[model samples]
Target: MLALGIEGSANKIGVGIVRLDGSILANPRHTYITPPGQGFLPRETAIHHQQHILPIVQAALKEAGVTPDQIDCLCYTRGPGMGAPLQAGAVVVRILSLLWKKPIVAVNHCVAHIEMGRVVTGAVDPVVLYVSGGNTQVIAYSEGKYRIFGETIDIAVGNCLDRFARVLKISNDPSPGYNIEQIAKKGNKFIELPYVVKGMDVSFSGILSFIEAVAVQQLETNEFTDADLCFSLQETVFAMLVEITERAMAHCDKKDVLVVGGVGCNIRLQDMMRIMCSERGGNLYATDDRYCVDNGAMIAYTGLLAFANGVTTPLEEATFTQRFRTDDVHAVWREKKSLPLKENGVVNPGIN
Candidate 1:
């Protein structure tokens, strides 16, 4: 069986085709980039997706060497994203579903990332560190859900990075985070930034505020270079992420940690996580940008898993939301495990 998936939750729009055996036949995507010192708006981003979705879908099918008749199902990101962009993908999937007389599956954006990480890295039951432009969450499967162990109390780590890049007037062509990662390599100074980790949850708004309020002026004064700011921000936020992920792993008694999401492609973040995992005698599982960044292939593979397990979205219920929580999905595809013992002040009723 083959499935076609569309993803336009944020600035990126992707179309992918996947076989039932977890093989990605085609995965093509385009990102809606803004000028330096600017960020993408939801309305404009949605328009970009609307303009490119059809062509991207066509390109995916052609590259996959498949016909519309061969596709058994349709899938799209259903939530936890910009409403307008989510609607752009959802409407296209609905149209395709009706036109092709195929089934539809509404996949959670975050779970798709985790499932993609699992399939790509062969990680089994690993704690997930999901970091993206809009979300920062530490999660793991428990009972019938991908339980959220921790998350951002305010702005996400990626958003903080992107906004700082805007202040620095860095290019957003590939990604703000990626550009920051590149320039950070040249940094020699480690400007101490606010490090906030409240229990398992992290707060980046204060850090962002500090840098925006102080670091920008310091950059003009030549007290620190832009590279130094980037380096300091990455180190501060990634350390918080590593701390929470390790804490979640200890809480769940899991030996493996998987990083998934757009920001998960950061080399420094991966290095820090690897070090943390190694110190705990565990493993760090991550993928390159092709899989780590949001893509339709992840959605297709995840929706395929759900479809195989007797799940499908009805036309009337084919909807998207901006506030869909990760724990709300009833991940019926995985087997339920017994609860774990409380650790570090966290009570685990199941294996999260």
Candidate 2:
């Protein structure tokens, strides 16, 4: 079946078309760029989506060379995002559903990230480390739900980075995180920062506070370059993420670690996790910006999975929420037992 997905969960507005076999026909996106020392506001971002949704959807359909009637289903991110942006996509999705007479499926934003990671990388039953602006979670499947094994008790890792970038007046064009990564490559000095990990949960608010203070002090005294602050922040935060993911791996007895969400696109974080997995005799799976960051492809793919398995969101009950949890939706597609995975010198011998 062919599915068309609309994603405006955050500042980025994207449209994706996908097939049932996990082939992406078209994935296009436009991000709302804020000035330096600024963050995206929901109102402005939603307006951006409203202005661009029509063109984005048209571009996606044209690029895929498929008519609206050819689309088997319409998929959109329902929640766990900014309310206005979700509504922006929802309004368009409702209009498309009415015009084309296609079924609508609501998808969890976080679940979309996980499903995208699984499909793109073929990482079957891998422990998921979902880190983004609004969320940071370590997930494993259990009882028809993606259970949160660990998460941030305070601010999410990406939020911390973005806020810190604002303090340093970094560019948010591509992304604040990407700018930090670029600056970090030039850094040679590493400043000590607070590292907090309690059991499976990690905390970044305290770390951010300390880093912000250090940046302020250095700015006044000219003691360190901005690269030093960026380097220190990335090392400290990525290390905490790796530590928690490792704990989840040990607890679940899984050898594969699949990283998802926007922050998963970070090369430094991937490198840190890769080293940990290599030392522990496991594998680390991650994706590039296209799949890692929020996109319509993942949303479409996940919605198709559910729609084929007898799931639909009627217009009356179609609504969006800002606080939707990953475990809220019951996945009828994923099986309870683990799917076959390639053995990387861990517990599994071969595909059963």
Candidate 3:
């Protein structure tokens, strides 16, 4: 059994192939880089996906050393993203599903990230900290569902960073957040910023507003460097994130922490998480840019799991939405197990 997946929920367009055993054969991706002080538009991103979808698909197939006829199923991210981009990818997915006579599986974007992190990093049922441009949540599995333990109330972490990068007029070459991470390394001072963590959830809009105002003042007075602002933003925001994650871990009684999503690729964030986990006598598991960000391999692997468990999307029922909650999907693929957050970390069945 083979799966071909498409991921174009945001600025990046990715295609990948994976086998039934959770091994990736090929994954190719291209991101749309907007100029400084600008953000990605849905229509433009959709057009970008439409233009490169075929070439990237061909490239992925060739890299995987497989032909189109060898593919048994087609998968695409179904929701929780810009509608235009999802429709663009869906058009391709539907065409391929019809032309190749393969069943299509619509995977939840957030669930795919969790499944991918678990597969690649070998984190067996860890508390997942999913931080992406569109979402920020600390998730855990309980009662056959991935429940949101903590999340952002306003803007996502990555979106905050991206919008802040625009205020700083930084390059969006690879990504605004990535560039901010690099610049933060050069900063030594940490200016105090608003830290808001209500219960288990976080809010980044106030922090963003604070930084934007500081940037305006600094631009006129040259009082604070961009590096300092970047450093301050990362430290404050990541601290809030770590705080919430630790709360979730303590509440769930789980030691292992798995960080997924695009914002998970930040080295500083990983370091902070590692320190926090070590304090709790636990470990932090993360991935590189490949699986951490939106990619086709995650979709392929996740979709394969769903398909094998008798899940499929008919053409008429394959419509995408802008808000697909992770807990909405019934996770019938995983076994019921007891994983106390703080104990010995041994998973036992029949304890749910």
Q: Tens digit of lDDT per residue, candidate 2, span 258-352?
A: 99999999998998998898898988888888788899988998998899888999986677889999999898989532222111212222111
lDDT tens readout by residue for model 3, 135-251: 999999999899999999999999999999988889998899999999999988789999999999999999999889999999899888999999999999999999999999999
Candidate 1 displacement at residue 61 in angstroms: 0.9
Question: Which segments of candidate 2 are over 4 A away from where they belong?
Answer: 336-352
lDDT of 1 by residue, 286-328 (tens): 8788888989898998898888889999998999999999999
Q: Give me the displacement of residue 176 in model 3, in angstroms.
A: 0.5
Task: Estimate TM-scores for all models.
Answer: 0.94, 0.95, 0.94
State the number of backbone clashes in model 3: 4
**lDDT agreement with native, every candidate:** 0.88, 0.89, 0.89
